[model samples]
Target: MLFILAAIVLTAHAASYGVDIAESISTSSIKCLRDLGFNSFFIFRAWRSLGSFDPNAKSINENALAAGFSAKHIDAYFYPCFSCGDPAGQVKSFWNQVTSKKLKFERLWFDIEGTWSSSKSSNRKFFESLTNEAAAIGIKSGIYASYYNWEDIVGLDYKFSRAGSWPIWYPHYDGKKTFSDFKSFGGWTSPYMKQYNGDMTACSHDVDYNYRP
Candidate 1:
């Protein structure tokens, strides 16, 4: 019984930590993060805001994998530029760049913060186009947004059909490393992961600390 209890505690702790990175870092830096208890890594696959792919994405992902992080625990995220238009094209570009480099990731997370168009309908359509394109390519997708950002960009009352089923990664930046403060938004009653801290350096690498529980 004691052994079982200890195993349960270990499992729970292992499932609760992650980090997302935009900058390129060495494999040793990734191993450092792993040593600090971050088991999951989310790397930026695209930067639509800059109208280009993240040049460092593949390298960061490769470093994480080299550090012994499983592909299943490493994922990709796309920062969409609402004004860039051609949402479908953006998705295709993201998919192409990631595949071209053979980066390993389990899912694609759509970063849904920042400025949006004045028209909510247009914003919703843009989002739908992105997800639709991702679905057509057979890649699973998720969303990363906070309640305020969702409300500002997509409206508080707006809910997508797949929002409930799609995994959500929300940010709070309270430095708590837990999901106690998450509020339902965009049809997500709970979050699959929480970004509890932002713009911090750990092990000589810049990262946003995240947790999944």
Candidate 2:
């Protein structure tokens, strides 16, 4: 039937598309993002390095809730910026924010970078603790890192263990390329998401475009 064929066509076109934004990107709004071809969003809930929370996350969560966005349509994550005064305490603070504000997300991602880790052992330990904390709270977690960051900070021979099992949202950008160009980074093979464009202008707002495959 023509109706059944049309349903299949729309189903194939319903692949997930998302964008990641932080408080620093002041122009970004949930309404504009959704209107500009993005069906899902990954908003920063907290930044550990600053030893504080991002107030924007709460607003975005509220906006998404009011807009009737489902959990499958949004993701909230915490970013632990470089070597802070207390890594363990930073993780705890992020946990507290989620509970107090009642934020909900299907998955969390750890923003890993080269400048964050002091040494391989310390870097490994940070992820180990983050993984444990995520497990306790009943949330799936992943790593957001480029291959260069993983090798530069964590060492090429480093064994990630529990954290290694976490999905990777690889960032290997080459402007205006197909998602098939997304390559494996660090120790992860077959990344869960590909950030294809970092400096993309969508709805007149700068956003990092991502594809969920």
Candidate 3:
């Protein structure tokens, strides 16, 4: 039946589609996105650039839950301040904020695209400390970056030891929901998630579309 086939297609589409949100969205808008077949949501937990927490982190997470998203369907991301000394300390501050606000997430994604220090060693140390500290706190972590960004920030030759184990969420704004273009970098031969689109609106909310395949 055509109806049955459509349902199957929608289910498959939902399984691969997700969105990462930075702005605060209402519960109604969250529900709208869910109804539109977005299966997962990644929310910003903190903004390390300003050394401050995202004021809407708690509300947006609570709203997502209220809209029927579970812990497994939601995750948090942090944008680190590259020049912020003591990367471990920054992670501590991030965790503290998460606990203080009681925000629940399945994993923490490190947003790795931005200005960097002149020293590649310093940059590598910053990323290493971030993941190491996340492990210390018993929370899983992943990287959100493109091959170009990764190579620029950490250098292509320097492969991270834990890259094989840690999942990677990369970005390629080609508007296609597949990972056909992912180039191996940072020791990751493949990606766990691909952000195929960025800076777009759906359900009247600003979101970057992502896919997991």
Candidate 4:
């Protein structure tokens, strides 16, 4: 079974996103955001290890799913900032936990927050290979990063992160956040939600590319 299932060991992706504040929110707090059009935000924080990161989010994924959002919208950011083991092993563990028979997700999010010098290169290659594996399984793969990281660490000339046609979930918070992907990941909290849930939108983007026609 392990050999036949070597794909996950190859690269399927696994990263965490935000902290664990969503768990403390009012039972209805999460719904309020979803109710107020904040339906797609993740709160899965990751831990970067030696040469890879492990992402096995259970609490967050379950909470979001119970709240009524589709599994696709309920995503996590996997940060492999310090991975050293077979990226394949870590990736496999994540997939098994994430896509268990009970909960089926259509896509997984790959976050590259950057950790060490070598990590930058390792993360780049990992994501590239993950994009291919995800496609084979009929799932979407993506990389999350800030504008500064994009232009600086990832380099302006590199094209593979965005090349697999995987959508980019860029997190930017000034006043409002936007994206060409139509879907977003930030700025949904306000004075009211703050009191009720104390959780804020880590990032948000416009996946539709709406132009107000």
Q: Per-residue lDDT of 1-213 in model 2, one digit per residue for the tens?
A: 999999998875666677776644333355667766676555445554465678777776766656556765667666775546455566677878878988866777878774655678877777667667677766677878777778787776764665466887877787543456654545565677778788777666567888774
Q: Candidate 1 overall Cα lDDT vs. reference?
A: 0.83
**Tens-digit lDDT track for model 3 on 1-213?**
999999999877665677888888998998888777685655555555665678988898888888888878788888888776777888898889889889887888889988988788989888898788988898788888888988888899988787887799998999987778989988899889988888898999789888886
- Report every candidate's CA lDDT: 0.83, 0.68, 0.82, 0.44
Error of 1 at 62 (Å): 1.2
> For residues 8-91, what per-residue lDDT tens digits would candidate 4 score against the true structure?
655422311222231233325556555544554434433234333233345545656677756665555455533454455556
Candidates sorted by lDDT, best first: 1, 3, 2, 4
Residue 103 lDDT (model 1): 82
Q: Given candidate 1, what's the lDDT at residue 22? A: 81
Give the TM-score of each candidate: 0.91, 0.81, 0.91, 0.57
lDDT of 1 by residue, 58-147 (tens): 888888788998888788888987778898998888788878889888888999988888888889899899888988898888998889
Which structure is stronger by lDDT: 1 or 2?
1
Q: Which ten residues in a row have the lowest lDDT in candidate 2?
A: 22-31
**Candidate 3 wrong stretches, greater than 4 Å:** 1-14
How many collisions per candidate? Answer: 0, 1, 0, 25
* Residue 204 Cα positional deviation in candidate 2, in Å, after optimal superposition: 4.2
User: Residue 161 of model 3: what lDDT?
Assistant: 81
